[model samples]
Target: MATRSNQCDFIGAGGIIRDHNGDWLSGLSMNLGVGQVINDEAKRMLSGLKLASNLNTRKLEGESNLAIVAKLLIEVCPISHPLDNIINSCRHLINGFDEVQIRHIFRECNCIADALAKGSLSRDYGIVSVVETVSFDAPPPHAASAFTDDLCDLARAGSVRTRP
Candidate 1:
């Protein structure tokens, strides 16, 4: 999930479902028209989290680039932050899995999802304040062929691995 800092604030969230062997199964990308960067980031997390939860796959490992969001998901209580509502929603999604693990990765390793998100930002704003969801068989326009290799490298990278 990511936020596009432009004249019109945009939030982009993306998820790629893969098999146990790490083969890609499907992908989803959502673009939301919201100006707040934090809110957009939270929304992106929530959207991706919900998508994974709905898959009915019991054991799952989720990754995010935002440490704050991962921390909030682990400590669901406190609720002191302004984004408590969004954080709580993420907590609810985490409950769906029999065993769920969340970790934070470097921004560089999150290229595929980031590209999908940026693509959402560049898309035509139909309603100005609408959320658009797109499922792709191939990389979106914003993502290039090189991103595929980066995605593969990210899957194999062992740095900054966490179970937060």
Candidate 2:
């Protein structure tokens, strides 16, 4: 998730769904009008989790640049916060999976999603498909590079923190 201003309001949210083999499945980008960054981050995470579940993903791993959002999703963040309702809903979605992992990633490593979010900022308040290639050949010129970058990131060697 990203914000258009220094106050961290007016969010731009985006996420990508990929297979274990690093093949792209689907992706989403949305412009979430005006809200706090953390709130928008949580909302985007819930949407991403729902998308994964819809794709029948059982053992899922998700990463976000916002450590607070990651913490909230895993119940490490304070429970009495204002986003408790949304956080609880996220927990429910997580429980639906056989195994789920949500990790905090550095902003530099989350470039593809960031680019997608920026691309979505100019659109309406809904999903914008940045990349949805289903073929074995190759994606379009603009998306091929982003796809490659995300594939490398997915294949990168890093230990993920377990859910709380």
Candidate 3:
């Protein structure tokens, strides 16, 4: 993800797991919407941790990438939308089909997907990029570094908060 162009970078991704109290964060491994595994490299990063104790239940919850991206798409697409074909296709792939509100996307307003695809591909999180179906010639120079300065300043400059 660090190799995408400037427009491709952002903050608040690749999180590490947090303690129950939210002290530390882990982007240790990715959870695809269903029982699928992507980013085996990330799985290796947290190999030493006992993640089985970290599964999501009613009391303790973790999210898949689809959940996170579907939310953002719902919120800031900058227009009213209808449940559409593309969204249905995505929903079919996603595990919790009931959770997502499918909607149409104007190609013009979906810069988020475009940016995410570039970043995902660069990081070789191909499950995300391929599922998203965005293609590019490869990111330009300074794409990753330029975004590091602004987006890396997470959540009020070193102040982390508990989930409310």
Give the candidate order by descending lDDT: 2, 1, 3
Candidate 2 TM-score to native: 0.76
The TM-score of predicted model 3 comes to: 0.24
Residue range with the least summed lDDT across 10 consecutive positions in model 3:
154-163
Error in Å for residue 99 of model 2: 0.5
Q: Which is the better candidate, 1 or 2, if ranked by lDDT?
A: 2
For all candidates, what are the clash counts? 0, 0, 9
* Candidate 1: C-alpha lDDT: 0.63
Model 1 agreement with the true structure over 18-94: per-residue lDDT tens digits: 54555454566776766665676677667766665565566777767777766777765575888889888887877
Which regions of candidate 3 deviate over 4 angstroms? 1-12, 23-25, 28-54, 60-122, 125-128, 131-164
Q: TM-score for every candidate vs. truth?
A: 0.78, 0.76, 0.24
Give the per-residue lDDT of model 3 (tens digit) for 28-95.
22222222222221121122122312323112223323332335334443234342433333333333
Q: Which candidate has the highest lDDT of all?
A: 2
Off by over 4 Å in 2: 3-9, 76-79, 126-143, 152-164
Would you list the clashing residue pairs of candidate 2? none
Q: Write the candidate numbers in order of decreasing TM-score.
A: 1, 2, 3
CA lDDT of every candidate: 0.63, 0.65, 0.28
